[model samples]
Target: MAVFEGTFAGDVSNLKIAIVIGRFNDLVTDKLISGCQDCLKRHGINIEPNNGQVDYVWVPGSYEIAMVARQLALTGGYNAIICLGAVIRGQTPHFDYVSSEAAKGVAAASFQTGVPVIFGVLTVDTMQQALERAGIKSNLGWNYALNALEMASLMQQIQNTSSSPSAANLPPGNETIALPKVTT
Candidate 1:
């Protein structure tokens, strides 16, 4: 089997990143956003207005992240969008609905806009897990931001690659090969 994936060696200095955060769980989402910003800065990405290396937007809750994300993505100004939110499971069924919908919406936005929408939302059963993932122990938000950078660079590389191979680069008998469309 053949396997292909994005690498972490991509340059993030020139890539524009948007951070969509949820304010409902301000305690947790704040940490997540901090981690994401820290990671981007560590990789030499500027968060200035002119450079446009990073843009930050806050929504009321996780439920609204997708719509705003879709709008920003549609503008075609961002190379990647990172969503950060916390949806801790409670006694009610609200957790399931919010978490699932957020995930689906984020994915849909990415698919429809051809932009990398990295999901850093936490759907944990407890506050501890959410905090841990946010930055207490692992800082998944930072990791997610890095992932977005890698994917953006990878997609750009793939799109720039020729779908059709020249005769010289093709196999012995096959002079040409059909190239699959690499979606942004």
Candidate 2:
């Protein structure tokens, strides 16, 4: 049995997050939005701060999440982006296309911009699965929020490390110093 433990201790108080929600299944997506907000709030995040700590924008559907996320990342304003949506599989092949496209698009956006874009969109075959994953009754938003916070922290760390000069970049073995002789 494989257990998935969420172990992320990151401080995101100084970072900004952009949440792009898709309005496909309003009911399900709404719950996700609530979860995201509640989780963020629990982490000391103010989504609607007048001074701008977090920002939210609603897209038409799941397909648009990537475009919006990409735009936000490219603008270089937010430290991270969370794409939240619910695409319950339908009777047609359209389900596969939307779900896969959304996933790929989000991935592409994150890779291209070098920003952490979390994939909070739920692609389930049934409404029950979506609900279960969302932790509507079990309060699973905690997990999602943790994911966002951790990813944001990771990105920040990478950015900081890359910009700073490290010992490895210094002249080979130039860090060595002469040792003084002890009392004879």
Candidate 3:
């Protein structure tokens, strides 16, 4: 049997994350939030005393996550934003529109604002799928949380590399240097 262990050694000490959850599927969203919080805490991020490390907000539904996330990213307070929602397929085409719009909107917000906006939304064909993804037994929330943290860390790395004068002035010969392998 293969075994996996959780480890946190990346430079996420000063990163700030904003979680915008959709109340449409409160249960699943809550699980996502819990997982996100656990991951953040494990990474040495402080969320209390107005430390401005982590914050969260609730919106009406999945369709509203993009707008709220965009607004939060525009505030220049958070390094990354995690949008959580669950859209279960219904009998109508409403699910298609909402899911596509939410995904595109979040992507647009990330590109336009230059902030890392993670799409943690679950677009499932059944409630069972959502439940399975949210349940601790399945470890889906843990997976999503890991994704969010990795994305946040990547964004920070990019920002840091872009802002450094030496990096900006890299010689053409060193432009394609390979990145070190990631152990975990």
Candidate 4:
């Protein structure tokens, strides 16, 4: 049997990546950006502001991340996208709405465009938890970057693979089954 999978191992110098950040929670999102940049830089991807291989896009808040991400993905300019934001629970239900919608949007963008969109938003109960996850304890941005790399590599492999083999090339005892034709 043949198996296919993605890994965090690849030459990232030629990969084009984009990061979408929400300014609503800059305090925590900034750290996530830092961790993400560190991971990309370590993998040999240039991290310069504009001319670098990685491009950064800023949105008003997490709620807008999905729209921008979908637009970018539609451009076919980036191999993968990373979205970072923080939506802390508040007295109202605003947190739930924003976080849930952001996640769904990010997912929809990837599904519709066939691009790897990494959702790095943090939905925490408190500022302390957000800070800890952003950088104090660990940085999820780094992991998100790694995911982008692996997914991009895998996508490249999938796209570059040869087309399906013909029935004549099938191994013995594995003949192709013919479907009956129906006339409407």
Tens-digit lDDT string for candidate 2 (112-154)? 8877788888898999988887765653445566687877766
What TM-score goes with each of the models? 0.83, 0.81, 0.80, 0.87
Ranking 2 against 4 by TM-score, winner: 4
Task: Give the C-alpha lDDT of model 4.
Answer: 0.86
**What lDDT does the true structure give each of the candidates?**
0.81, 0.75, 0.76, 0.86
Kindly report which residue stretches of model 4 are placed more than 4 angstroms away from their true locations once superposed: 162-184
lDDT agreement of model 2 with the native:
0.75
After superposition, the stretches of candidate 3 with alpha carbons farther than 4 Å from their true spots are 1-11, 47-51, 167-184
- lDDT, model 4, position 13: 64
lDDT, candidate 3, 1-184, per-residue tens: 2223323566666667788889998988888777777777776777463666777789999999999999988887776788899999999999999999999999998887877788888999988888888774563555556666776666556555655676646777766232222221
Compared with the true structure, model 4 gives a TM-score of: 0.87
Q: Which stretches of candidate 1 lie over 4 Å from their true place?
A: 1-5, 48-51, 162-184
Tens-digit lDDT track of model 4 for 72-106: 88888788999999999999999989999999999
User: What shift in Å separates residue 45 of candidate 1 from its native position after superposition?
Assistant: 0.5
Which is the better candidate, 2 or 3, if ranked by TM-score? 2
Tens-digit lDDT string for candidate 1 (1-184): 2244676664555677889999998899989878887888877788664665788899999999999999988887887899999999999999999999999999999888878898888999999999889878988878988888787776665544435344347557844322223222
Candidate 2: deviation at residue 150, Å? Answer: 0.7
